[model samples]
Every structure is written in C-alpha cells, then in structure tokens.
Target: MDCDVLIVGGGVAGLSLAWRLSPSRSVVLVEAEGSLAYHTSSRSARQMQPSYGPAAIQELTRRSIAMVEGISERLPAPIMVPRAMLTLGTETEVAALVAANANLESLTHSETMERSPDLRPETFEASALDGTAMEVDVPALLEFYRRQAIGTGAMVLTGAPVTAVEVVASEPAGGTDAEGAGAEDLPTRFHVTAGRHSITAGTVVDAAGAWADVVAAQFGARPRGLQPHRRSVAIVSTEHPVDPSGPMVEPADESFYYRPDGTHLLISPCESVPAEPGDAQVVDEDIAELIHRIGEVTTVGITGVERSWTGLRTQPADGLPVVGFDADVPNLFWLAGQGGYGIQTSAALATLAAGLLTGTLPDDDGWLAGALSPQRAGLG
Candidate 1:
C-alpha cells in the first residue's frame, strides 16, 4: 500500500489528522485493534472544558474554544452542545482561578449556580465559571472527521498493527491513485508491515496516542520525552433527577470533577498517575480515591457505580501536543501527546498537522506558536 501519510493510531489524534490531510493527500490510518478509537479516545470524559492543564495546553485549548462554541455554525450542527463549565474551589483556588483566568472572565455565585444549581457553597470556599465550557459529542466528532477523510480518498484500516516499519528510500505503497486505483510509484520506499501485508508512504504520522512513544522508537526516533499517564473515571448511577443541562464541575482546586452523561454522571478524580501506555483498566484503589474526592464537593453521593474504566493520557514534559515533523526523523511527524484534551483540540491540531507536513507551518496564534512547538519539551 502506498500513501502520502501513514497514521498509526485511529484515535482522535490520528483520525483527525488523516481527515484534514485527506483532501489533498493520500492518508492511511492504521489501528491496532479491530475497531477505531477503542482505547483512550473512546473512553474520554466526553466533555469539552477549555480551562485546565498547563499554559501551552491552555493555549491550544484556547484555540479550540471557538471551535467548540461555534461547532454548529462552523462544521456540523451538533458536534458541541452548550453546557456551561464551572470551576469550584477553595478561597485560594478561587483567587487563582480568578487571577489567571480570562476564560472564566466573570465570576459570581448566582452566575456559578446558574450553570450547576446543585453546587453547594457551604462545602466550597469559592467557585468560578468557564461560561465557554461545553459538552462535546466526541464519537460524533470523530465520525465526522472519519467521514470527511474517507469521502476525500483517505483510507482507514482497523485490526492492523504496524508490526515492522523499514524506511526504504521513497516510493509508493497501497491505496487508490489520482485516477482512483491502487498503485505504487517511485524508487526505494518506506516499507511498513501490518500483519502479513506491506504498505509504503512518503511520510508516517505517529498519532498512536498511548503507543506513540513505542512507535516513535521503532521508526528510529529518539524523542526527548514522551510521557504517558493513566487516569480513571467512573460512570455511576446518580439515579437522582439531575438536570441534563447541568454544567461540568471541578470541586475545590479540581481534585475531582463530575460531568453529566445522560441520567448518570461521569465522576473522575481528575488525577494523573505516571504509567506505561497500553491497555488500561480501572483499579479499585483509584476508584476509591475518586469516590472520596467527589464526596468533598457534592452533597449527593455515588449511589451506584454502573461501570468504570481507565485510559492513558500521553504527553511531553512541557505539556503541549507535538504536531509537526520530528526534530530528528526526516519523514516522521509527531501528532501525539494530546493528553486529555485530544477531543477538544482535534480541529486545530489537524490543521497544524496538515500545515507541518505540507511545509506550511501555522502562523503565530500569538502565544500559541511557541506553546505547540516540540522544542518547548526539549524534543527539538
């Protein structure tokens, strides 16, 4: 198989980039599992909260705000649903939220309660609002990108793990040509083996999400740092008649948060523990911790834990996604390390990935340019 770009992971990172690049380039997304995005991407918090994480991460997320706010107006009508976000904290955390947060420009008790009426001020010392925060239809959004990519000639292959990748000179592999037929062109090419089948492409994208570090190493990439961590969330039966329109909440310094997922609420410890990325499962201790943290905020308790799961959020030390060609590897691109913000930041990231691969780097979105560069993480 011949392709202009080979995307390793079929998660949000890989699928979004492939979709964006497919209009003018031959992009192939390879997923190790039988289905696309079966891992962390599928197991997201399923909400879009713009404010959180490090400065660089915030910048990328800041770019994503407009996309979230105006999803219907921009691409699709229902990708992002309006569900105001609230950040509840102690007095000190409130001050921190107020001081550095332009995203949460205005704060008030009435305003805060408007988003999450169930918030109890007696328990929380202070609270603020991220009025811009909203719930994202992550699966729909992923499918939107996938449909766009396939419609534009991008090929997606599931149940295929890239076993061996030998960087040949540069030739063609699989997939339809300009005339819509599978063909290969050029001399020596980068040979990528999936199962027993071989494919080639001009450039390969390491959007393998948690497995990105391993893929990078296999492709002769020596990354400065590619860190992966595990975080868990529990979908419990709050069986209480909670408003579906309730805003997402982070209690007293974001120790934990609960987002509305239909009648049930998605509760998480908002904690990240260092771990090697792969198949992740929920731990009992972590679940206990999550329950304990939620108690500190909500008067209502987890009546029942319908289900629980865990996933990996891979990132660099400096905490921004890598969205361009590797600093060392010539044809390899870094579209990994999105952490928990992958679904929210996919649109902008796809643009960055496309621009970087085509030699047209993105313009300075003010502080955003320096934030997204891998150099900040010492990867450059």
Candidate 2:
C-alpha cells in the first residue's frame, strides 16, 4: 500500500496524530498488538494533572485539556470530570509545592483532614490541593480519536508488527526530486514490511511506546537512548466505605498515589524502575510496599488486591518528549519519549506534530518547537 504518512504505533500519540493529519493526508497506522492502546496508554492512571511534569509538558497538557473540553459535548461521555488532587507532605514539601504552583491551595492539618478523613493526622504536617485536576475517561478519548481517524480516511491496522524498514529514496535538500516533480509525483521515501502487509510512504513516524528506540534503529535512525520504566498499579477493596467525592490522594514526594474507584481504590507505587520493551508484570513486592506506605499514612485499610497491572513509561535522557523530524534521517519524524505525560498532552503534541509535518506551524511558537525538537541538546 502507498500513503503519505505511515505511523508505526497505535497508542494515543499515533491515533491523535492520525486523526489530525488524515483530513489532509493519506495516513496509515500500524500497531503490533492485536488491539490499539494495549500497553501504556491503556494502563494509565487516567488523571490529567495540569501541574505535573516539566514546564514544557505542563503547557502542552493545559493546551490538550482545553482541546478535550471543547469536544466533550460531542463525545459519548464527558472526557474529564472534576477530581481534585490532594498532595500530602511535610511543611517544607507543602511550602515548595505552593511556591511552584500558584493555583495550589496550601492546606493545614485540619483542612487536610476535613477533605480526606482517612488520612493519618500525624503522618503529614501539611498538604496542598489542586482543584484543577480531573479524572480522564481514557477509553472514551481513545475511541473518539480512533473513530475520527477511521472516519476521515486513515487506515488503522492491528497486529501488524513492523519487521523491516528500508529507505527507498533520499529526499532532496529542497524536499523534491532533482527533476522538480509536482507534489503528487513526489518520490516515496520509506518502504516498510509489517507482518503480512507491505507499505510505501513519503514519511514515517515512530511512536512506539516502549519500543520506540528499537523502531528507530530498524529504520536506520539513531536511537535516542529512550528508557522504559515500569510503573505498577493495583485496585484494592477498602475496609471502610470509600467516599466517592473524596479527592485523589498523593504524597508530595510522589512515593505513591491513590484515588477512589467505585467501591474500591486505585493505587500505584509511582515506581520508575528501568525495564526492557515488552509487556510489564506487576511485582508483588512493589504492591506490598505500596500497601505498607498507605497504612502508615491512611486509615482506609486495603483488605486485598482485586486486580493489578504494570505499564512502561518511556523517557529520553532529559525526560521530555521527542517531537519533530529526525536530524540525521530524512523523512523520519519522532513522537516518542512522552513518559507518563502522553495522554494528558496528546492533543497538543498531535497538533504540534501536524504543523511540523505540513510546515504550517506559527512562527511565534519557535520556543516550543525548539523545546520539543528531536535534536535538542541534552537529549539522546
């Protein structure tokens, strides 16, 4: 098959980009798994914390939240629901958080207990509340992107693991053939073999979550030293009745986090252990540690784990996403190394990527463009 763009991952990043680009370009998205978003995207904590991540990521997340809210009325269900994030910590930690986020409300011990009575009073000296946080309906958002992309003419293929990528032709410096052919007659740049399908396209995007670097190497592009870290989460039933309206609880130190999930609680150790690219497994020890930590800080006893899972959050050396075209490989673009911020920043990243691909990005956004550039200094 021939296309203008070939996206080599069907996670939120690839799907969102396909949705944005399919209106003006012939796009083909291929996923190795039998289903889209079968990895990190599906295993997310499903919360959009605007204050989270680095400055660049926070800006992208804010942009993405607005975009999602704009489309909420059209979706089958609301994509975001108000869920304040209550961060518990010592007085020093709370002070630091207050200094960093202007919107965060510093909470005294009494105020913290008023918001979440389950928290142990003596464990934390103070806390902060970010009322802007929201619980994201990840499935709804993913389906919206997938349906929009397919509806607009993008072909999405599942179980199509790419086996080989060959550079069919070198792009000229001026971005056309030496003969100066018309746009419709431009030379193909990549020939890709994935499972039972063969594809040729003018551009290739590497959005493979944990295997992003592996995919880049397959295309003869330099690996960006992306590291995949395993984060484990578990759902456990509480001994007491969980308050559905209670805020999501997390420590300022980020050792762990927990939020109400129906009658149970969704909890994570917030661990970032380096891992290889593959399906991650939950470590019993990690869950044990998480339970112990919760016991020290909360009165809501976890009776037993109802379910547990793990996912890989990929990150570059500097812990920022890699966007824009590859500096060394012509016609190759990167949309990887989003780490844990992928879902929250998908829309903005997709918009930025589409602009970069089509050369229509506003000139005023140069700072952002430079920040996310694949060749930016300190990033592999």
Candidate 3:
C-alpha cells in the first residue's frame, strides 16, 4: 500500500489530520489497535475548560473551539456541548481567582459567575465560573473524523502497528523530479511495515500519542523529552442527590477536580507520574487520594466507586506537544506529546501539522519554533 501521507495512531490527533489531509491528498492512516481511541482519547475527562491552563495552551484551545464545535456542515453530530467550569480556592487563593477572572474577561466575553450558592464559600476563599468551557463527546469526535477521512478518499487501516521504518537513504527507485528540489533532488520515501502490510508514503506523520517516542526511535530519531505519565479517573455512584447540571468544579489550587456526569460524578485526582504508554489500571493509592479529595471538595454522600481506569498523558520536558516536521529525518512529520489537552487541541494542531506537511504553513504562528519544532526540544 502507498499514499501521499501515512498517519500513525488513530487518536484525535491522527484522525483529525487524516480528515484534513485526505481531502486534498491520497492519505492512509494506520492504528495498532482494532478500534480507534481505545486509550487516552477515550479515557479523557472530556471537559473543555477554556481558561484552565497556560497562555499558549489557552491560545491553542481557543483556536480549536471553532473546529470542535464542528464547522457548519462539517460533522454529522455535535462534538461540543457547552458546560460551565468553576475554580474554587481557599482565602489564600482568592487573589489567584481574581487574576483568572481578569484573564478570561480579556480573552472572551463568556458568562462569569463569581459565587454559587450551591457551593460552600467558607472553605473557598475565591470562586469563578468559566462560561466558555464545554464538554466534548470524544467518541463521537473520533467517529466524526473517521467518517470525514473515509468519505473523502482516505483509507484507514486498523490493527496495523508500524514495526519498522525504511527511510530511503538514496534516491528512491522511482525518484521523481519533484518541484523546488533545488540542487538537492533526493527522492524522500518512508517504507513502514505494519501488521501484514508494507506501506510506503511520500510523508510519514507520527501521531502515535503516548508511543510517539517509540515510533520516532524506529526512524533512527532519538526522543528529546517525550514523557508519558499516568492519570487516573473514577466514576462514583453517590447516594446523595446533587445537581446533575451543576458546574464542573476544579480545585483553586489545581488539585483534584470533579464534574457532574449524569447521575454520577466523574472525578480525577490530577495525579501524574512518569510512565510508558498503555491501558493503565487505577492504583489503590490513587483511588484513596481521589476519595480524600472528593470528601474535601463536596458534601455529597460518600458512595462506592462505579468504575475506574487510568490513561497516559504524554508531555515533553517543557510540557507541550510536538507538531511540525523533523529537522533531520526526511519525509517524517511529528504530532505528538499533547499531554491532557490533545482532544481540545487537536483541530488546531492538526491544521498546523497538515500545513507543515503540505509546505503551506503560515509564516508567523510563533508555533514553528516553540512547541512544534522537534529541534527546539533537542529531539532532533
């Protein structure tokens, strides 16, 4: 099999790029697993807290909001549902809450709620509502991308784990006189062997999420600071009656967070650890810590946990995703290390990745040098 672009990993990053690129080029995507997003993408808390992170992240997420909301006539289903988020902190943290409110006011005109009678203000020195935050149906999103890619002549092959990459060292057997080769006209090629097939592509995009580093290593590329960490979540069936539509709550100190999920509550301890990519299990200690946070955050009934699981949150040393062409490796592109914001940041990053691959990337996104450049992180 062969294509103009071959994308590895079927998470939001890969599928989003595939959907974008396949419309203009012959693209093929491969996923190691039989199904798409069976890991982190699926395990994400799926909340779009717009003003909850760094300034760069806020910019990237704001850029993605238009896409996740699904451009008119683009998706069959609505991928984004507006839901408010609140940050509650102790009296000592009131100043930070005020600062957050100021930032959000400048960035967007979304609603703001300073106090919620439903919450205890005595324990919380400050609290603010994020009107711009939204909830995303990640599964629906994955399917949406899949449909877009397949509908537009792109091929998606599942259970296709890339084992080895064959970089065309010399001029490809059928070296082409591609335009703008200048004095260097070496035909660039990547032969990736995955499952029972050897697929060649003019360009290879590594969107393999937590395993992106491993994929890079296969191409003789040393990973710079790719670090995959463990994040655990649980849904507890509290007997106490709580507002099903209540605001998603985050600790003022950025500790644990909980959101109203239907009749139950989805909670996270916000814990992270250096680990590899895989379907992680909920550790007992992590579970205990979460329970503690739950008690501290709300007066809801202390009920049993309905379900629990863990996922990988990959981040570079500087804590941002890599989303540009490789500095040294010919014909290879990168779109990985999205941390927990991959879902929220996918569309923007996908657009940027596509732009880079097509050689049509804009000049002044400031993204080329910071988070996107593999060389900037010493990964090249």
Candidate 4:
C-alpha cells in the first residue's frame, strides 16, 4: 500500500494528526496494539488543566482548550465537564504556588476545610483554587478523532506493529536519464513493514509514545534520549461521602493528588520511575507510598484498593514534546514525548504539526512552532 503520510502510532497524538491531515493527504495510521489508545492515552488522569506542565506544554494546552471545546459541541455527548482545582500548600511552598498562579489567593484552613471536608486542615497552612480546570471525557474525545479521521478516508490498522523502515533517496521527480538521474535531488521515501503488511509513503511520522526513539532508530535516525517513566494510580473506596463536584485536591508542591472518581477517590503518588517500554502493571510499593503521602494531607482512610493500574509518561530531558521533522532523517516527523499532558494539548499540537508539514502555519503560532522544533532538542 502507498500513502502520503504513514503514521506509526494510534494514540491521541497520531490519531489527531491523521484526522487533521486526512482532509487533503492520504493518511494511514498503524497501531501496535489490538485497539487504539491501549496505553498512555487510555490510562490518563483524564483531566484538562490549562495551567499544568512545563511552559511550552502550557502554551499548547491553552491553545487546545478552544479547539477541544469546539469539537465537544459536535459530539453527541459532552466531552468536557467543569471541575475546579485546589492546591493545599504550607508557608514553604508559597513561592511555588504564587509562581504557578498569578492570581492565587490564600485560603484559610477553615475555608479550605469547607471546600473539601476530607482534607486535614491542620496539615495545610494555605490553599488556592483554580476554577478553570475540567474533567475530560477521554473515551469520547478519542472516538471523535478516530471517527473524523476515518470519515475523511484515512485508513487505520490495529495490531499491525511497524518492525522496520527503509528510507530511499533518489533523483528529483520527472527528471531521469539512462546513464544517471537528472536534477540529482529529490525528496526521500519510506518503506515500512508492519506484521505482514508493507507500506510506502512520502513521509513517516514517529508518534509511538514510549517507543518513539526506538522507532526513530529503525529509520537510521538517532534517538533523542526519550525516557519512559512509570506512573501509577490506585482507586480506593472513600471513607466519607465525597463530593463529586469537589475540586481535584493535591499538595501545592504536587507530591501526590487525590480526586473524586465517582463514589471512590483516585489517588496517586505522582511518581515517575524510569522503565522500559511495554505493558505496565501497578507496583504495590508505589501504591503504599501513595497511601502514605495522602495520609499526610487528608483524613480519608483507604480501607481497600478496588483497582490499580500504571501508564508510561515518556518525556524528553526538557519535559516538552518533540513535534517537528527529525533533523537527520528526511521526511520523518517527530510527534512524541508528550508526557502526561498529551490529551489536553492534542488539538493544538496536531494543528501546529500539520501546519508545519504543509508550510501554512499562521504568524501567531510561530513561537510554539519554533519551541517544539527538533532543533530545540539539539538534534539540528
């Protein structure tokens, strides 16, 4: 098979990009799993916080909110639901809290207690509320993008893992001679093999999430030192009647967080341990650490762990996503390393990437385009 673009991952980033480009490009998405979003994309915290993560990510997320909201309108069900954010802090964390929120206001222990009754007031000296955060319907969002891409004639293949790629460079188009090629310059092509299927495309995209660098190496591109970090979450029964409308509660320093997940509360240690890329399972020790940390700030008691799971947050050294063409590989794009902020930033990041590929990005997106370029990571 042949296409204009061959996307190597079916996660939100890859799916969203394919959807955006398929209107004018022959796009084909190949997933290593039996189904789409079987990894980090499905195992997310499922929250959309515009002010979260590094500066570059924040920019992309801020730009994505409008796009996400717009897409939500077209979906049969609501994709975004309002949910405030509350960060409990001590005096030592005042500077960090202030830096994170310019308009942060001090919440007295009494006021904080009133907002989230489960929090142990004595453990916190101050608190701030971010009213703009929301809970994202990840399943619906992913489905929307998938349906849009397929409707636009993009082919999606699951359980077909790309194992090899060969880049072929030849003479310019429509200029050839018997002895030697005329022009002697042309764009490269990628021949990819996935399972029993073989595909050729003018451009290839490495959006394999945790396996991004591994995919890069298959096409003779140097790895960008992308590291996959394991993050675990535990869903436990709530001892008290937790408010479903309650804001997501965490320490101002973000050591751990616990939020209402139906009648149960989902708590996490916010741990990021380096690991190999594969199916991730929850660690008992990590869950114990999460419980210990939550006990430090909340009065809730975890009687039982209903369920637990783990996901990989692949991050580069700078903690920003790499989203441009590889500096060394011709026609190969870099669209991985989104960390934990992939879902919230998918819309804007997709648009930005497609714009870069088509050379039609607006003047307003120049900063983000440059910041996420492969050159910023010293690959240029």
Candidate 5:
C-alpha cells in the first residue's frame, strides 16, 4: 500500500497527528502493541497541568488547555474533570517555587490545612494551588483520536510490529515538472514493513515513545540519544479517611507525590531513573521508598498494599520533545521525546507537527519550530 505519510507508533502522539493530518493526506499508522497506547500513553498521570514541564512543553501544554477544554465538541465523551493541584514546599524552597512559576499563589499553612487536612502542616512551610489543573480522561481521549483517524480514511494498524524501514533516494515514476525534476531525480521515500503489511510513503513520522531512537536507527536516521526513565506508581489503602475531592498533592521539589484515587491514594516516588525501553515493572525498593516518603509529608498511614505498576518516560538528551523534520533525512519527520507531558501537550503538539509536515505553519511559529527542531538536540 502507498500513503503520503506513515506514522510509526500508535501512542497518543502518532494517533493525534494522524487524526490531524488524515483529512489532507493519505495516512497510515502502525503500532507494535496489540492495542493502542499499551505503554506510556495509557500509563500517564492523567493530569492536565500546563505549568508542569520544560519551557517548550509548557508553551505547548498551555496552548493545549484551550483545545482540551473544547474537545468535548469533537469527542463522544468528556475528557476532563475539575481537579486542583497543590505544590507544597519547605521554607527554603518557597522563593524558588515562586520564581519558577509566578502563577503559583502563595498559600498560608492554615489555608493549606483547610484545603488538604491529610497533609502534615509542619512538613510543608509553603503551598501554592493551580486551580486549572484537572484529571484527564486519557482512555477516552485516545479512543477519540483512534476513531477519528479511522473515520477520516486513515488506516490504523494495531498488533503490527514494524520490522524494517527502508529509506533510499528514489524518484517518482512520473516526472514532476513543477520541481523541474526528472523521473530519475527526486528526494527519498520511506518503505515501511509491519508484520505482513508493507507501506510506501513520501514521509515518515517517529512517535515510538521510548523506542524512538530504535525506530530512527532502523530507518538509517541518527539516533538522538533518547533515554527512557522508569517511573513507578503505587496504590495503597490509607488508615485515615481521605477526602476524595481533595486537590492532588505533591512536594514542590517532587520528592514524592500522592493523590486521592477514589477511597484509596495513588502515590509515586517521583523517581525517573534511566532504564532500557520495554515493558516496565515496579521494584520492591521503589515501592518501599514511596511508602516511607509518603509518611514524611502526610499524616496518613498505609494500612494495606493494593497494587503498583511502572512506565517509561522517554526524554531526549536536552529534555525537550524532538519535533519537526530530520535535518539530515529528507521526508523524515519526528514527533518523539515527549517525556511525561505527552498527553497534556498532545493537542497543540499534534497541530504544530501536522502544520510543519504540510508546510502550512505560520512564520511566527518559528520560535516553537526552533525549540522542537531535531537539529536543536544534534539528532540530525
């Protein structure tokens, strides 16, 4: 089969971009897993906090807020629920927290206690709340993207593991008089093979999460030194009753974090250690550390263990998403290295990436283009 674009990976990044590009281009998306979002996309924190992440990610997420808020019109179900976020800091970290984000409203200890009585008042010397934060309906959002892409004539292949990507300088069989190029002289095209299916496309987008560099290498593109960090989360029952509606809580330094998950609490050690990309598993040491850290910030006691899991957060060397075309490989676009902010920034990033791919991006978007460029990280 032939398409104008072939997207590698069926995570939120690839699905959303296919949704955005399908109306104007013949698109085909392939996922290695049996279903969409079997990895990081499904294992996200599911919070829409534009304030979290790097400068470019912050800009993308901030812009995505509008799209997320208005997404109900496009999807069959709502994708967000109102939830507040509190970033707690010690006395020494107050100034740094405020400097890092001017939007963080300084809250008194009394106010913090009133907002979340479960937190140990003495352990937190400063508190700030971002009222705009919300719990994202990640599954619903992924479903919407998948459905829309298919509905718009894009082929989405799940359980289709891409085994090879052949990139070679080849001309279109027909001469392109507009480019003054003969049938023998044109740029390259990508021949992608997934399972028993083969697709030829003028462009290919890498959105393979932790396996992004692997995908690039398969296609003869330079690997960007992409690193996958293991993040573990645990769910445990608390001895003390917690308000189900309370704001999500975390230390300003992010040593550890816990949020009410129905009657229980979901906690994370805030760990991001480098790991090989694959199905991630929770380690006993990480869970033990999480329980110990929770005791430091909260008065609640863990009564019983419930469950735990781990996921990979892929970050490029420079720690920003690598978007835009490969500077060295013609027709090779990149949409990887989103780290933990992939879901929150998907709407805006997909729009930006689709626009860049089609050459319709506004000139003023050059700042964003430069920031997310593959060359910026020397991945070219």
Candidate 6:
C-alpha cells in the first residue's frame, strides 16, 4: 500500500492526526491492539482543565476544548459537560496558588465546605475553584475522529504492530544522484512492514504513546528519553449518596484527586512511578494508600473498592509533547510524549502536527512549533 503519511498508533493522537491529514493526504493508521484506544486513551480521568499541566499544555488544551465545543452539535452526544475543579490545600498553599494563576478563585474553609460537604473541615485551611473544568466524553470523541478519518478514505488497520522499517532515499532535485547529493538534500520514503501488511509512505509518524521511543529507535532515529509513568485509579463505594454534580477535588500539591461517579467515588493517588511500556496493572498497596488518604481528607466513608485500573503517561524530560520531524532521520515525524494531557490536547496538537507535516503552519504559531519540536532543547 502506498500512502502520503503512515501513523503507527490507534490512540487519540494518531486517530486525530489521521482525521486531519486524511482529507488532504493519503493516510494509513496501524494499531498493535485489536481495537482502538486500548491503552492510556481508554483509561483517562476524562476531564479537561485549562489550569492543568505546563503553560504550553494549557494553551493546547484551551484550544482543544474550544474546538470540541464548536463541534458538539454535530456529534451524536455532547462531548464536554460542566465539571468544576476544586483544589484544596493549607492557607499558605492556597495563597501561592492564587498568586500563580489569576483564574483560580480563592475560597475560605467555610466556603470550600459549602461547595463540597463531603470534605472534612479540619483537613484543609483553604481552597481554590476553577469553574471552567469539564468532563470529557472520551468514547464519543475517539469514535468521532475514527469515523471522520475512515469517511475521508483513511485506511485503519488493527492488530498490526510495525515490525520493520527500511528507508529509501529519493533522488535529490535537479537530477542529483544519491552519491553526489548531501544527506539533507535527499528526500526519503519508508517501506514499513506491520504484521501482515506492507506499506510505503513518504512520511512516518511515531505516535506509539508509551512505546514512542521504541518506535523511533526502529527508524534509526535517536530516542527522546521518553519515560512512561504509571498512574492508577480506583472506584470505591461511598457510604453516603454522592452528589453527581459535585466538583472534582484535589490537593494543591496534586497528591490525590477524586470525583463523584454515580453512587461511587473515583479516586487516584496521582502517582507517577517509572514503568516499562506494557499493560499496567493496579497495585493493591497504592489503592489502599489512596483510600486511607481520602478517608483522612473527606467524610465520605469508602466501604469497598468496586474496581481499579492503571495507565501509562509517557513524557519527555521537559514534560512536553515531541512533534515535528526528527533532526537526524529524514521524513520521520514524532507525535508522542503527551503525558497525562493527551486526550485533552489531542485536537490542537493534531491540528498543529498536521500543519507542520503539510508545511502550512501559520507564521504566528512559530513559538508553538519551536516548543513542541523533536529537536527542541531540554528534550534530551
């Protein structure tokens, strides 16, 4: 099969980029899993907060949320639902948070309790509220991109892990031969073998989430030192009826967070333990510690753990995504290391990456282009 771009991942990152680029270019997406979103994208907190992550990520997330909201009417169901985020901490911590972000509304202990009655009064001295947070319908969003990409003639293959890649250098312009042309002067194509399928493409995108660096290595590209961190979540039954509309609560330090999920509460320790790329399993000790912490911070007694799961948040050393072409490997692009913000920032990142791939990025986005560049400083 011949394509303009070959994407090696089936998560939101790859799917979104396929949706964007397929309309203009011949695109093919291959996934190792039997179905799409089998990894981190399927195991998200499903919330988009503008105050989350680093400044660049926040910008991308804000743009992505706007894009999602703009297209909500066309989708089968609403993708973004209102869900505020309440950050609790000591008086000193709260003051620092207010000083850092002007958008956060500082609240006294009394005000915080009024907003979330489940919180214990003695646990936190003050809190801050970010009312712009929303619960994302991840399934609907992923499906939308998949349908759009397929509708636009993009080929999507499942259970097809890329096994080998051979670089075929195109002759330089002006009839220059390979031996006489400089490496930078030659354009490159890739012959990729993934499972039973063989594909040839002008550009190859590594969007393999936790296995991003591994994929880069296969293409003779330098690994970007991407680390996969395990983040675990547990669903526990609450002794009292939990309000469905209640705000998601977390510490200012981000030690743990919880939100209402019907009659139960979904809690996470916000742990980022270094892990290998594979199916992440829940640790009983981590869940026990999270339950103990929540019990101390809130009056909502956790009766039993209904279920639990874990996901990997792959990140670079600088904690930003790596987009754009590799400095050494010609025609190879990276769309990885999105960390915990992949789902929230998928739309904007996809749009930016598509522009970079097609060489149509606006002049005003030079800063973003530099920030997410695979060759950017601090990525080592």
Winning model by TM-score: 6
Clashing pairs in 4: none
lDDT per model, in order?
0.76, 0.91, 0.77, 0.85, 0.86, 0.92
Per-residue lDDT value at 247 in model 3: 74
TM-score of each model, paired residue for residue: 0.88, 0.95, 0.89, 0.94, 0.94, 0.96
Which digits, one per residue and each the tens of the lDDT, describe model 3 over residues 1-380? 87889999988899999988987899989999998887788888987666856666777788888777655246666767777777765544645565765433211112222333344444555556678888887887778888989999999888999998887644544554555443245656788898887998888888998899889888877785788899988888776766677778777667788877887888888889888688777787888878876776567765888888899999887777787778778777888988988988777778887877887778877654365677773542
lDDT tens readout by residue for model 5, 164-205? 878766666665677677655767777888988998999999
lDDT of 3: 0.77
How many clashes (backbone atoms < 3 Å, residues ≥3 apart in a chain or on different chains) does model 5 have? 0
Q: Which ten contiguous residues of candidate 1 have the minimum total lDDT?
A: 180-189
Question: In each prediction, how many residue pairs overlap at the backbone (N, C-alpha, C within less than 3 A)?
Answer: 7, 0, 0, 0, 0, 0
RMSD of 6: 2.2
What RMSD does each model have against the real structure?
A: 5.4, 3.0, 3.9, 2.1, 2.2, 2.2
Candidate 6's residue-wise lDDT over 1-380, tens digit each?
99999999999999999989999999999999999999999999998988888888889989999999976878767878988899999899988987887558899989999899998888889999989888888999998899999999999999999999899876556675647766456678899999899999999999999999999999999999999999999889988889988999999889899999777899998999999999999989999999988999889999999999999999998999999999898889999999999988999999999999999999988899899999988775
Please state the error at residue 291 of candidate 1 in Å. 2.7
Give the candidate order by descending lDDT: 6, 2, 5, 4, 3, 1
Model 1, 332-376: lDDT tens per residue?
878888888888788877877787778676566435545666555
Give the TM-score (vs. native) of candidate 5: 0.94
Model 4 RMSD to the real structure?
A: 2.1
Top of the candidates by lDDT = 6
Off by over 4 Å in 6: 171-186
lDDT of 4 at 30: 96
Candidate 4 lDDT over residue span 1-380, tens digit each: 99999999999999999889999899999999999999999988888886687677877777787788899898787889877778887765754666666535567778878889887767888777777777888988999899999999999999989988777765465667666766535677888998778999999999999999999889888888789999988888866767788889888768788888887888888888999999988989889877877776677777778999999999788888888988788888999989889998998899999998887899988898788877784532
